[model samples]
Target: MVFYCQRHCYETKYTTKVVSCKPAKIDVVVDGKKKKTACYEVTFEDTILFPEGGGQPDDRGTAGGVEVVRVVRRGGEAVHYLAGGLEEGATVTQEVDWTRRHDHMQQHSAQHLVTAVADNLYGFATTSWYLGEAVCHIELHTGQVTEEEMAKIEDTANQKIRESTPVTIAEYQASDPRLIEIRTRGLPEDVVGAVRVVSIEGVDANMCCGTHVDSMADLQAVKLLHTEKGKAGKTLLFFVAGSRLLSYLGECVSRERGLNTLLHSCPADHTRLVEKNQKELKGAQKSLREALKDLAVCEAKTFLGVEPRPPAFFHHRHDGDNDYLSAIINEINDESVLKVLTAGEDKGPGILVVHGPPALVAQIGPRVCEILEGRGGGKTRFSGKVTRLGKRKEAEKYVLGALNGSVKET
Candidate 1:
């Protein structure tokens, strides 16, 4: 449905008449499926809630006892999305989400002040901005920002907030020559006739349509959290304003206290303690690895001394790995005795290693792997791990059969 161009609804908190209302089909995701929800698309003759635009989210509240989910601006009309339908030409009392609206005002206004301060003091112009749930950020036309520079900008912004300067909204025609005196990112291509400008008295002025509080004092405060690199050599400065600042501080304090308890160290020493513990862990792991290698060498000796020379030797070891197998193979000096070693946990995957005569190695390794349903690659000394547990006997039988000429070598 088409809507006429009209004044913004947020100039004052006033009850107004509904100009139009119609059924709007919206797709909502429920249980991983899209379900169409028929809602009321409403427009008011005048309203107090701000439609989403200019990096600020839509205002939410109730209209005539019906929940308003979202508001959008097309041309001059403030479209409201309502759960239940409203009758056309109905007189409804509308209330803006005061908490949410006020929060946006604080963050947006702080953004303007901070951007102006950065441009004036550091020649860093604002390229973009975002008003997120817990934090807001402004992208500046520079790749990097130092902590000292951000601290200065934050201090200046809070100073302006403390001064409680008045903020004014004004409208001027597009053709007005006085427009040259004001600062603006630029006008939208579709904009016609007059343009609305929000001005912070004695500080800065810019063309904007989002709602704002009456004075800087209402902003409460602006805190710079950190900065990150952005597109086109830009720097994104993250921050929180007003009550969000208080909430962020509360969360940080809680985390600091929790870390002290968990680490059993003061906040100043937490990093040092963590680093020291990591070094100790690395040392312990090195010692354990060396001890395991020594054990592997001793195990290889027992199989070498066995008398009744079997066609091929098979051993099921419930521990160690390729490193252990290699250590044992390196110690077995006999060149003719074929060795098949399978090592793993009681009920887990197993590793197989075959070493000895080149012809026997080629014959036994492939046959053993085929029976166990595993894959591996090597010339004479072959190694591969099987997925099944306790299948060591099956692999050993295949190797023994190959030696007896009952199983064909691949």
Candidate 2:
């Protein structure tokens, strides 16, 4: 069946009788929770709203003055999911969201042009394609697409657009002999009626049921963004067409302006300046790690110098990491002295490490972790991530009290 929207691609409004209307539920996310939403699954004798198919999303518009949230193809019918109910057999006006419809038409037609040019220049067949929210991509059967080849394909596609090549469509029965010469991925198992073939003048012709622009001129432009590796040894060519291309360029300019302010350099020198800054950061990190190691040794020496070494020693540093805390225990190298060490932000998140006699360490590790809102367990050494660094003082006092009590009993 040739849908009304497919037949009159430019039509924005149509009056039709409602063929069916039934209660339905659709899944929706509310405040990060998924739940069911009540709606009506409606069908009209004919509609100007295109249903979701052929890699193109469903059109957003209104039916009987009620917002249509979604539309999908069920066999030969376009089912519209309306937020409000419409009475069956009632006459109503259906409006198409032209902005969204036009965008889809531009992109869908551009894909045909791009696919044809790539295949003609190089035998790269389009395995699949995706019309994403922000960009569109065509997955080619080839293993890789070189930068030079991408430029050539993009140039050829836009050249056709510049010429304002006419895009025409033809419909034929499923068993027509002319179908032999046309390119097709395949038709749906449930496909009914005629097969629609969209052709770009002298460039190429292929079977497609999706809506498209009347001519290549409607595309305005095509920009090949980049390429990425796809599964099964394919290459995905990403691009934006028409208004999307303009929007993408605007975003790039905005980002460049922000980078200029942040780096105090122009776009031409951004790469060099960023690389130099990254190298400097690595050097600073190396210096900080070495200083932390030295600080660990000094802390161990200070604890050992005490004539009456405390049974339990607690140490905290707002810098460093778990490795730095472990270094202090390694430097101390004494099982008799219990060591409780933490490193990170004073009032934020940190790591905790405890090392001592086997029995004492096992008994005290879990309790200390609980106090600091963390979790860890070990026989003679315990380590874990801590979240409540603000409770450090209370944890230290509890550990010291436990060790002093154990000492008195011994």
Most accurate candidate by lDDT: 2
State the displacement of the C-alpha of residue 113, model 1, in Å, after optimal TM-score superposition: 0.9
Per candidate, the number of residue pairs that clash is: 0, 0
Question: All candidates: CA RMSD in angstroms?
Answer: 6.2, 2.1
Give one digit per residue, the lDDT tens place, for model 2 in 1-410.
77999989999999999999999998767898988999999999988999988899989999989999999988888889999999888999999999999989999999999999999999999988999989999999999999999999999999999999999999999999999889989888878889999999999999988999999999999999999999999999999999888888999999999999999999999999999999999999999999999999899899989988777889999997876888899999988778888888898888999898889889898999999999777878988888998999999889878877887999
Residue 88, candidate 2: C-alpha displacement in angstroms = 1.7
lDDT of 2 at 367: 94
Cα deviation of 317 in candidate 2 (Å)? 2.4
Q: Provide TM-scores for the models.
A: 0.71, 0.93
Clashing pairs in 1: none
Cα deviation of 296 in candidate 2 (Å)? 2.6
Best by TM-score: 2
As a whole number from 0 to 100, the lDDT of residue 291 in candidate 2 is 95
